[model samples]
Target chain A: MKWESVSDFFAMGGYGLYVWGSYLVAVLCVIGEIIAIRIRRRTLYKHLGLRKRSILRGEK
Target chain B: MTINWFKYASPASFYFLAGRMIPYFSIAAIIFLIVGLYIAFFSAPTDFQQGEAYRIIFIHVPAAWMSMFLYVVMAFWAGIGLAFNTRLSSMVASAIAPTGAMFTFLALWTGAWWGKPMWGTWWVWDARLTSELILFFLYIGFMSLQAAIDDPRRADKAGAIIALVGVVNIPIIYFSVQWWNTLHQGASVSLIQSPKMATAMLSGMLIMALAVWMYSIVMILIRARLIILERERHTAWVSELKEGVLE
Candidate 1:
């Protein structure tokens, strides 16, 4: 808010790189965890479905 | 009525309980994060010295605290699993590792960011930072070792051992600033004493810490659910649950 313009906010009084970079990394980590959890969930569901089908078919 | 807390420690019971909990924790985490960010950016006074740079502390300190807290939690679960041979304990331990590692990375990254302006360096080999880096590696090592093993039981045992060993590093990380003269600042807040920071600043930090705590629980619960579904796919309970869901 103190910044004269949008660029000044990004500049972060010359520590912009460090400040923004750190926040960026933190954001990315959260996103990464969400994606990983979703992927793992899908895989688990698939495995469970396959196992159930095999059991119903008496193939296990 | 005796509520058996230990019963929930069973994977099946934990699975359902975690399912019920995930939504609550997620909502709580979101609310806290919004409130925390609002107070941090708007209410907390700008530092007399650091100006805007001090704002980063809101996120940095909470992430740092969660990183350490999660590791201790993971190790605690690992120990419980090892001692009691509880399937859910191992699953919980496994579920927490990646999240813990992510927080560790966040803490380190934020610390580097905070350090650059205040300490005149983007990176330092101070005891705190070095020990934190080691914690990150320990997380990776535990996950990798678990993945490499073919047997789940064996993987759990191996991961538990590694996590227990890594627990030693946690105290070292905590005491690093106190034990050595480092560029990193000492703790502003401790359990035994009132925080050194202004009330507004401390409030923001506490809110952020609560946000991180809730987020960790939600993530771990989601992960543990998946672990239970995988490990118990052959069980009658899972089969019935799958049927109920499908219908």
Candidate 2:
């Protein structure tokens, strides 16, 4: 509602680049952190799974 | 009829509780982010002087606040772990590090973005800016110190000392603009004074701050759960969990 047109919204009164740049960095940081957590969790589970299997094999 | 306050002091119970709570926090974070962004971009009027450039404050202020708040929480848990020797407390302290560092980095990044146009420069060594940069380094130092140690107990104690010592910087960062002349402006939204921003703008910023709060809780909980598993791999409960749950 602040802008008359779509381009005007993106243009951000000619301060578009700075405003959007700050937001873009924020998005990247959030995504990067989530991805890092996922990778760490996966690696951990895989390691634990392997250890469980090895222990079972020894028992058998 | 009284709830057991110390029941969740154990990592095993906390892990399951965190797992169950993540979905709710994640939902709240997502919802708040959507509403906050909508208000920030559409509902809030442009500033008379700075125009759209002032919009950077939406994220910048929130990130900066979180950076400071998370450090205090991290240090609190670290201290509790040191004093009481609680494993969950230590795990929580360690889990908060990377996210706190991320927010600190975001604050600096967004601050630079805001400064480039408004101040005509990307960087300054003003008291506020310099102190914030030091806070960032403190987070990095805590993480690196903990990572350097092989034993978890020693790492937690070492990190706690650094975190507690670094607490002196938070007040400095908060009052830096007042204590000395600086390029960075004084706080617009303070507990002691009425906000200088428009109602809609303040609401949007506050909502975004809540969204960030929920997001941080989700991240820290997830990270703490992972830490619990990593440290308790030899425990019977972890083995049972591994056998019962693929996730």
Candidate 3:
């Protein structure tokens, strides 16, 4: 709303790259961390499943 | 009335509690960030001196604060764990390191980007910047030392020592600008003094800081749950949880 147009907004009044660049790094790191943490949880569940399956097979 | 403080100390209970708590924190983080960035980019007026470059401080300052704050929290938990031999305490310290490191990296990276335009240099050996970099290394050293050790107990103890020893660096990072003649600007907002910036800018930065805090809690809780599971994998409760025998 502060900018006259969309271009002005992205330009950040001549500081577009610096402002957005810092935010981009933050966004990427956050997204990457979320994915990483979720993946770790998924991997844990998968390992549990494998163990359960192995135990069942051995009992049979 | 007596409070059973140790009730949640067990990993199994803490795991479920963390799972339930994470959604609330994550949602709060999302809300705060959206509002904060909107105010930062749209509502906050451009600075008289710095034009738009000052906007980077929303992310940079908060990240920098979190980097130092989290380290202290991590060290506190690590120290407590080392003294009392509390499993959850050490697990918490371990869980905090990655997020702490991430914020530290963000602080440095964003500081570089912000500096390039304003200071006309992408990097500097300014006391503040150098001390912050050392804090980053401290985080790395804590994590690496833990990973190198095979035994979790030993790893936690070793990591705790480093974390405790590294607390000295945080005050250094904070006072570096004051302690030494540095290129980095001193604090814009301080508890002891009136804020130097406008209302809108101050609010946006504070909101962003809150968002960062919420995000950290969510991440730390998630990672802590995972650490709990991995370390307690051999326990009956973990096996039962895996088998869906204990819901």
Candidate 4:
């Protein structure tokens, strides 16, 4: 809204790269945490299932 | 109003409660992030002093605040576990460490980026910066110490001791600017005094701070649920959870 055009907005008055760089890294780290938690849940569940199946097989 | 907190304190109850909380917190985080950034980047006026470059404060301040705040919250949980021997309390402490560490890393990294332009240096060995760096090291040390120990109970005890001890550094980090002539600026926002920044800037930072707070809550709850599942796997409740998942 402050700029004449979209390019001017993206340029951020010549500090564009620094401004965008900081935000990009910040957002990626936020998303990365979510992904990491999901992976941990998946891995832990898979391991739990495997361990239980092995124990059941041994008992059979 | 009746509050049934005990029902939520157990791991089994907390897992379901946390699961219910995730969607609400996650959605709120997304909404706040969108609104905060919109106000920060577009609506917030450029500073007459620092120009557009000053916009970095939108991210840097919130990240730095979260870094300090999360460390304290983590320590609080660790202390609760230490004092009460509550199983869920320790799991909550464990869940917070990694997210706390991540925010600290972001604060340092973004601080350097802001510094390179403002201070004409990427980093300095000043009091505030140095103490913040020490805070980062404390987070790492807490995590590494817990992971090193094989027994979960022992690991929780060890990490709690370090977290409680490291709390002395937090006050040092907060008061470092006032205690010493540091290159870093004093806090613009404080309870005892009026904010030094513009209203729009202050509002943007506050919204972003809330957004980050919500984000941290979601992260901790998710991780804490997983920790509960892994630790309680041998219990019947966990088996039911696993069956629910498999089904």
Candidate 5:
């Protein structure tokens, strides 16, 4: 609220680049982790499903 | 009744326990972060020297602390895995590495931000900063080494060794200010003495530190659960777990 406008908020008293850059990197890292975990889960589930199906067919 | 501490060390047991713990840690992290940010922004007075720029310390110091703390934890778990050949240990270590690296990067980034306003530069090669950069590289090296190996057991062992070797750098990073002529200020709130800052500032920093700790625990628990599911996919317990969750 101290920042008068959107532009002022981004400016951060001339520390716009450094402050925003740090925050951006941190947020992106968290986002990356979430994406990586979801992908890993999907791959693991598919692999397990395939293996289970193969074993079932072999048993048949 | 005695609790079986070692039981939870088992991958399966840890999976369930970490699941339960995650929500608690997540809630605590959120509460503490909200409170800490409020205090940091509103209650703590601005510094005469650094003006509003000093507010960055609230996040920066906590991030730096967590960066170091998580690495030590990762190495500890890695050592356990190597000694006992336990799946859970390796999983814990792997879970912590990425988060540790993130915090390390945050520390450096915030430090650079703070530096630009006070020191008139975006970057510095001070002793503390240099050692912290090495810490970041160490995290990347550990993750890469683990990913490169085919055998999970062999990968854990190799990662453990690298982590142990990297442990030597932690002490160097902590003591760099005392050991060398560094632009970074020496510790103001060391364990040996009362903090030099005002009570409000110290309280805000401590609250932020607690929030960071909670956040790390929650993140690590989530990661470790994912590791458990991946590693234990062939086990009957995992099949049961999937069935129960799907239901």
Candidate 6:
């Protein structure tokens, strides 16, 4: 609402690069953390499943 | 009816509780983030002095606050675990390190980005910046210390000592601006004084802070649940959980 056009919003009154740079990295960090956790959860589930199968087979 | 608070102290109960709560927290985090970003870019008026560069404050301030706050929380849990020998408490302490480290990195990164245009330099060897960098190292130290030990109990105890000792740095990082004439500006929002910014700007920062807070809770709980699964894999309950999942 403050900007008159799309270019004005993106230009950010000449501080655009710094503002966007900060936000871009912040977003990437969040995404990276989420993906890392998901991978961890999947691996954990796989390990647990294998352990359960081994237990059913009377193996330690 | 008395609700037994300690009932949830066991990882088993806490894991399920966290699982149920994650959805709600995730929703809250999303909503707050959207609203906060809208207010930050659209609603809040541009700063007259700093122009648009000041917009970085929303992320930088919140990340810096969370970085320090999470370290304290991590240390508190670690200390409790050390005192009481609580497994879940130690697991929580370990779970918080990565997220704390992430925010610390964000704070420094965003600080550098904001600094480039405002301060005419990327970084300065100032007290606040140096202390925050040390906090990042502390997080890495805690995580690596735990990772190096084969035994979980030993790792937790060792990590707890470091975490508790590292608590001294937090207050230093917080008061650095006031204590030293640092390049970084002093806190705009303080407990004893009115905020120095416009209402919309203040609200946006606060809302972003809430969004980050909720997001932290979700990440910590998720990681804690994973730690529980890892450590408790030998237990019958974990085996039962596996069965429940398979079905």
lDDT of 3: 0.91
lDDT of 5 by residue, A26-45 (tens): 67776787787678656766
Candidate 2 regions exceeding 4 Å error are: A50-60, B245-247
Highest-scoring model, lDDT: 6
lDDT tens digits by residue: candidate 3, B150-179: 999999999999999999999999999899
For candidate 6, write residues B111-135 as lDDT tens digits: 9999999999989999999999999
Cα RMSD (Å) per model? 4.2, 4.0, 3.9, 4.5, 4.9, 3.8
What lDDT score is found at residue B153 in candidate 6? 99
**Chain A structural similarity (TM-score) per candidate?**
0.77, 0.78, 0.76, 0.74, 0.76, 0.78
Q: Write candidate 6's Cα lDDT for A3-54 as tens digits.
A: 8999999898999999999999999999999999989977886876664433
Per-residue lDDT for B1-247 in model 5, tens only?
9987799877877776776677789999999999998887668876767666777888889999999999999999999999988889999999999889989999998898888878888778888999999999999999999999988889999999999999999999999999999889898579988788989899999999999899889878877877787778778877765555322
DockQ of 1: 0.32
True contacts kept of 4: 0.45
CA lDDT scores, all candidates in order: 0.85, 0.91, 0.91, 0.86, 0.83, 0.92
Better of 4 and 6 by lDDT: 6
Better of 1 and 4 by TM-score: 4
TM-score of 6: 0.95
Alpha-carbon DockQ of candidate 5? 0.19
Candidate 1 chain A lDDT trough over 10 residues, lowest sum: A51-60
Q: Which portions of model 3 show Cα errors greater than 4 Å?
A: A50-60
